[model samples]
Target: MPLSSRLPILLACVVALGGCAGHPKGVMSPVAVSNKTGGSKVDMLVVTSRVPSDDPATLFTGERSPHPYLTDISVSIPSDSKRKAGTVQWPKKLPPNPDTDFAVTRVQQLKSVDQGRTWFRAHVVGGHALVFVHGFNNRYEDSVFRFAQIIHDSGAKVTPILFTWPSRASLFDYNYDKESTNYSRVAFEQTLRTLANDPNVKDITVMAHSMGTWLAMESLRQMAIRDGRVAPKIDNVILASPDIDVDVFARQWTEMGEKRPKFTIFVSQDDRALAASRFISGDVQRLGAINPADEPYRSKLEQAGITVIDLTKVKGGDSLNHGKFAESPQIVQLIGQRLVTGQTLTDSNVSLGQGVTAVIAGGV
Candidate 1:
């Protein structure tokens, strides 16, 4: 109601994002990889703009870095055949077991862009790649572990590239996190440009979650403005639980011009994290919290040929209902098989045929 009333509620939502400090720091420290290890592994090329941490274990901090930092990290997943999909099983103890925990199996620092290009040549099969952007309140290791889980569970057959930005990982630093995205826009744009320019990269899927969507959209908008269009290689843009202001997103979409990438958004009205974001931004509706089936959104989104999947009734492991995209097995795999892997999809009644039947609105 009043500003005083809203502040406490916003702070409470911020508190739901706690527990980052509870985990051990520097979980990125590489562990010995053994041929005898039973669990699976996911290796990612991480490009970050966060200042390198003084502690080697942590690798990067929330503060900004002058240059883009690159690393290749391998993560070991739990061996259980019945392991829950869309969840990162963080190690309860250090030097985690490959059979029972998510652990770092290998870590390497790429010396230069040439070295990264070499990676692209070696890894990108048939020119398919996935670029992931982590959201606010995430540390370096948090994004790593989560992206690893996604790649593992989604089973997307593509070169995995993670673009992690500087985030204090403190919910109280929400405004600072938002600004960090703005500051790192150029670096992120550079990342997209590099991938687009690579001959080995024929197709790219850019996926952004939470406030990272703001950064991703801005980068795309800038790219479209600079290059006369969003890169043709960047075919699909997935925004999940995006924390973008609706009006701002409309401007971004307009700036991207007519020949833009196909957009798919995952939204839920029950997203408490976005509710806090709404209050902090003067109650403007966030794009990820809209109902695509109703009102001005329905006609506008349909006219733009944008797809929106509403996950309001989709039960998620997240208490806040803010992470259904990453927390639900059906939805994540649907992303991998159909959208990220470059499948030809159409809007139909059986939207994303992964046993997830709650396709309330538009789809691709």
Candidate 2:
């Protein structure tokens, strides 16, 4: 065949290969990933209730009901270079080198957290562990990268574990995400129980974002209902940009009762994301966007024994203002050093560290 005759066939083949490359690569569990920010390799353990997708080549892509399966993975994230909070960046494509783009290096399978605990022991602080539950619109990779960013930014030695639910990973999937979160309640409880029951884990901190807060609270509430008390190992709870309804949150707290972990709720009146969520859900006030300076609202939360950090006044990073607790460098410092370490935070502490004048209601 002449050069002209072969050119069209070669071009067609190249185009087909490129199309296949863009499709889902499928799930690779127990994968090892390198971290560019800290220049280290970290392990990410996943516990999910999502069913296996037909694209079994990829991990956890099915939209079916909660059949609940657990996977442990490791991956490297893009480096911050700036070493500041609220500044995490992800690459558009997976590359050969983590320095170039985020990609998984290795993967291995594990039966349960027993194997994970071995890895967890190395990161524990004073025998403490940190459990993070991610919110709506998150895929497995998105959850892993965000968790790694938070852990790296916090500079805390505590072991970090992520509980990821089946999020449709779409803005239009709000209702689907809500149902998926609710469905994963039992599985989330199991993840907590695994940590709580482990003798190696003496103290634990639970953090949840957006819709994950609802799942975390409901899971704990269910455990409390069954055991008649919250786990003593759970020493602290952090709810960042929680998308729960104010009234529903009050009821959830009531169900869980007292003797719970020290509760910290990060709220911002200017959170446009939560504002949109409110508009979607019948115009009810979502918890994350609540103004702490309000008359009865502040009093109600304080009475419930919850600590509310109002971020309406603080500036820098996250224009939407829905993720300041983890995204804001100043607040991330507060969370990494004080919150996870079990240090009591006050107005002076905020001023001394972040140098921002914040409106903090309900605290010691």
Best by lDDT: 1
Go through the candidates in order and give the C-alpha RMSD of each one to the true structure: 2.3, 10.3
lDDT per prediction? 0.85, 0.71
lDDT of 1 by residue, 191-282 (tens): 99999998899999999999999999999999999989999999999999999999999999999998888788899988888988898788
Q: Which stretches of candidate 1 lie over 4 Å from their true place?
A: 1-5, 16-22, 344-364
TM-score, predicted candidate 1 vs. hidden true structure? 0.94
Error of 2 at 285 (Å): 0.8
Reference-based TM-score of each model: 0.94, 0.83
Query: What global local distance difference test value does model 1 have?
Result: 0.85
Cα lDDT of model 2 by residue, 341-364, tens digit: 777666665652443444454543
For residue 191, give model 1's deviation from the true position in Å: 0.5
Best by TM-score: 1
Q: Which window of 10 residues has the lowest lDDT sum in candidate 2? A: 17-26
